[model samples]
Target: MPLPGTKSRDAALIAEFRMISGASEKIASSFIKKYKSTEAALDAWYNDPASANGGTSTPNKGQEKKLGEIWEKYKDSSDPKLVKIDGTLAICEELGVDPGSDSVLFCLAADLDSKVTGEWEKEPFVKGLASYPGNIDSLTSLKNYLPALRKKLNTDPTYFKKVYMHTFTLAKGQDFGARTLQLDTALDLWTLFIPPALTSSPSALQRTSDQTPPQFAEEEFDLWIEFMRKKGKAVSKDTWSLLIDFIRSIDKDFKEYDDEGSWPSTIDDFVDFVRTRRSSK
Candidate 1:
């Protein structure tokens, strides 16, 4: 089960993710209900972080029957889209907001993942992973079901993955400004959250040129003044978002990364180290 104080927060996070990503609350609530119920079987997911396969390839009709009943009732509801609860677990693992944290955002992450998958955008989270707060090993893998409900996504995402590799890159940001990412990245100035799959390894944003990507580099106090002189927007939301993500990247994962015993005990530490390197360099 999620930690004691986390249930309501889960609701809120899912709600926020829903609003931002265009999901509905009713559907989020159902997911939480299922996640919390048979948690023991699934909770280990957090500690292990490697079992995020979306659907059981082999027959598991016993569990499927139980999950299908819920899917059948709510799947058709117009209030919100819902996948079979089991189908969602793998995606939830990748998204990382324990089904029980601030619901407002989980809903959004859920919807966002679904929409990204439905539209056949590069589904980064499909095989990504994250550490849950209380999980023993602090990691979980994520994947998608083979056949998705949305007809648009009937085609495999293998193509979308190629598009991501083909399109987004060092030059695009320079030519387009940060706005090129408006649709592709889930940037929120408010919560300082980014999809863990995409957000990890802040250093990964380094420019193809010797110079660092302007966004990942901390804006020195001097640059702030210069931008002010140039009448640049002092608080462009993206800048604010980058700033918040910087802080959160440190705050959430710093301990695991910077410790001199410093060897990464697990995957989280390795990812955290990537974030710290981005902030410092």
Candidate 2:
């Protein structure tokens, strides 16, 4: 028989443990009672596998069911298998995220392993959620996890690069035949991806201070945007992807830039633009 009040207070504990560890009800109950918390129980299960008995660290039936329910709830009504922009917006609303904020939206997309900007397929949705650490069986849990996900994006450079590269594809939309991103769109995306401090908006600065250090100063990003407005027609895939590399490799004053290096002509032109502005000042 289940322990007293297990149906009330301890239910979430058992469910989370079972979801992460793939333990049976009896096993989950035993571990919870022994360890006293979901994190502790999971720690014991992973650090000392014998304590888990036969429970495997994999998604179990319960997780699948819960994920399925969430999918059905958020999936596009017309397509049933896709979470379209409307569905995506609903999710953003639930999570208290601004759909207009590409920085946070892109991070969320990375977490969901989204393949498109406005659409999410069932497979990636299920696999991403199933593989995500911590409990995300409900929207509430997923919302609670967003801070950690954002922190990872801010702190983990490699992971941030993955999301950054992925954003190029997402921003391009479903036009597979297109080879370049629109200049206006690229400018908007750069503002979001580069760092919130670039905008000099009070809210963005606050967010930037709370997160990672800025990769480039506000003046640098502003100059780049100004140069783009003057000379850029469209942003090729190479330019779009290499901009991050440029920011990381070059200093704010362009002291480290090598004209002989393999930077794209667009970046080369921007450097020239910067030099001309500096010499005239």
Best candidate (score: lDDT): 2
lDDT of 1 by residue, 50-101 (tens): 3322223332444335333433433423424454344455435554535443
Worst 10 residues of 1 by lDDT: 145-154
TM-score against truth, every candidate: 0.24, 0.72
Question: Which consecutive 10 residues in model 2 have the weakest lDDT in total?
Answer: 200-209
Off by over 4 Å in 2: 1-57, 197-215
Tens digits of per-residue lDDT, candidate 2, 13-51, equal: 988867655556887888888888886676565445334
Per-model lDDT: 0.32, 0.71
Candidate 1 similarity to native, TM-score: 0.24
Could you report the Cα RMSD, in angstroms, for every candidate shown?
16.5, 9.6
